[model samples]
Target: MRHATYNVNGIRARLPRLLEWLEREKPDIVCLQELKCADESLPIADIEAAGYGAVWHGQKGFNGVAILARGDAPKLRRVGLPGDPDDSHSRYIEAEVGDYVVASLYLPNGNPVGTEKFDYKLKWMERLGSHARVLLAEERPTVLAGDWNVVPEDRDVFSAKATRHDALLQPETRAAYRTIVHQGWTDALRALHPGEDKLYTFWDYTAGCWQRDAGFRIDHLLCSPEAADRLRGAGVDKWARDQEKASDHAPAWVELV
Candidate 1:
């Protein structure tokens, strides 16, 4: 099986590119983040016509997530992350497809440190950690895939100095991400290309970041032990980012035997 994760930025605006990508890549399962459209506005017809069945949790004009399976609909598991009743962002969605539990998440971008947004980002990571513990205990084949909004290490970005003060590169943020990975999840891309540098999935739109190859590895696919056992290959679809009017993010994928 092949599974991929992509942060679409805005599904509506990127529908054409998304459709083109689905046709070319033909992944068995896809996790999408940052739909930036409400549930009612999701382009279900186009997605269905592309021969994929999808389940999405959408919010208006901002964060959202979805899972799509080719040939059949994904069995819904959870629509939102647990441990926070007041939290209303549509940033998480999970489903089961052929015994594998897959999740799409859009972690908060906590910019401008020393603010409530940053605090919420940390708290949200804590909740995710708690919930992830439960999932790990199950020992089922699982993949948590999407834009984590985190630059895990200095090597994951083009220049450590450029992003040193950014929230994604903050020590606290990296620590939270590490805590989750320490729970036995395999970072698929890193596992496949251990010593490779400048392998990135996201590039900012401004300052010719993509042209200059100044990018960041924020989109990830984290596989549990059960799924990791079947890991066959992984890669970033960098071509997608080079397309006309493309999203800042490109699809990152993993193949399993």
Candidate 2:
């Protein structure tokens, strides 16, 4: 099956592009992040009209996540990563699509270091790592797909030296991701495109980052060992970033057999 993850930035602002993508890609399932809409405000009718059923965890204007399965709505498994009582951002949502469990995540963008947001980001990472372990124990086809907000390595970004201090590319964030991978989760994209460099998933909106190809590969598809074993192919849809009024991040995907 073909599954895709996209950080649409804002569902309302990008609805047209999203519809176009659904028609073009026709993925069996789609995981989305940064919806920026409350549940009541989400365009459920539009999604259904596009031939998919969705389960979403939405926030007022910030983090949000949703899973859309073709034909029928997926069984809602959980919302938000486990392990934090005070954490209430609508940044994580998971569902069961057939035998596989899938989730769309919006990891905290820890900008301007030395702030509460940065600390929150780090704490969240720990929770996510724990949650990933639980999912890995299931030994089923599981996928944690989303805007991970961590640059896995210097090779994944355009200019590692320039972004070394950035929150997404920082040593702390990288270490957290490394720990997750150590638990036997596979970095699907890297596995597919090993040795290739400058593979980015996000570009800054300002400073003409897209034009200069100044970007970071912060979005990802981390697969459990079972799912990774079935991985057929994976890549980022770079063409989507060239669309008019395109989101800063493009769609990334994986195909499993």
TM-score of 1: 0.99
Error of 2 at 243 (Å): 1.1
State model 1's lDDT: 0.94
Q: Residue 167: error of model 1 in Å?
A: 0.1
Overall lDDT per candidate, in order of appearance: 0.94, 0.91
Candidate 2 residues 104-200, lDDT tens each?
9999989867888889899999999999999999999999999999988888888888877789888888899999999998999999999778778
In Å, residue 188's CA in model 1 sits off its true spot by: 0.7
Measured with C-alpha atoms, the lDDT of residue 131 in candidate 1 is 80
* lDDT of candidate 1 at residue 176, scale 0 to 100: 98
Instruction: Output the lDDT of residue 252, model 2.
Output: 92
Q: Which stretches of candidate 2 lie over 4 Å from their true place?
A: none
Q: Kindly report which residue stretches of model 1 are placed more than 4 angstroms away from their true locations once superposed.
A: none
Question: Counting only residues 3 or more apart in sequence or on different chains, how many pairs clash (N, Cα, C under 3 Å) in candidate 1?
Answer: 0
Choose the strongest candidate by TM-score.
Answer: 1
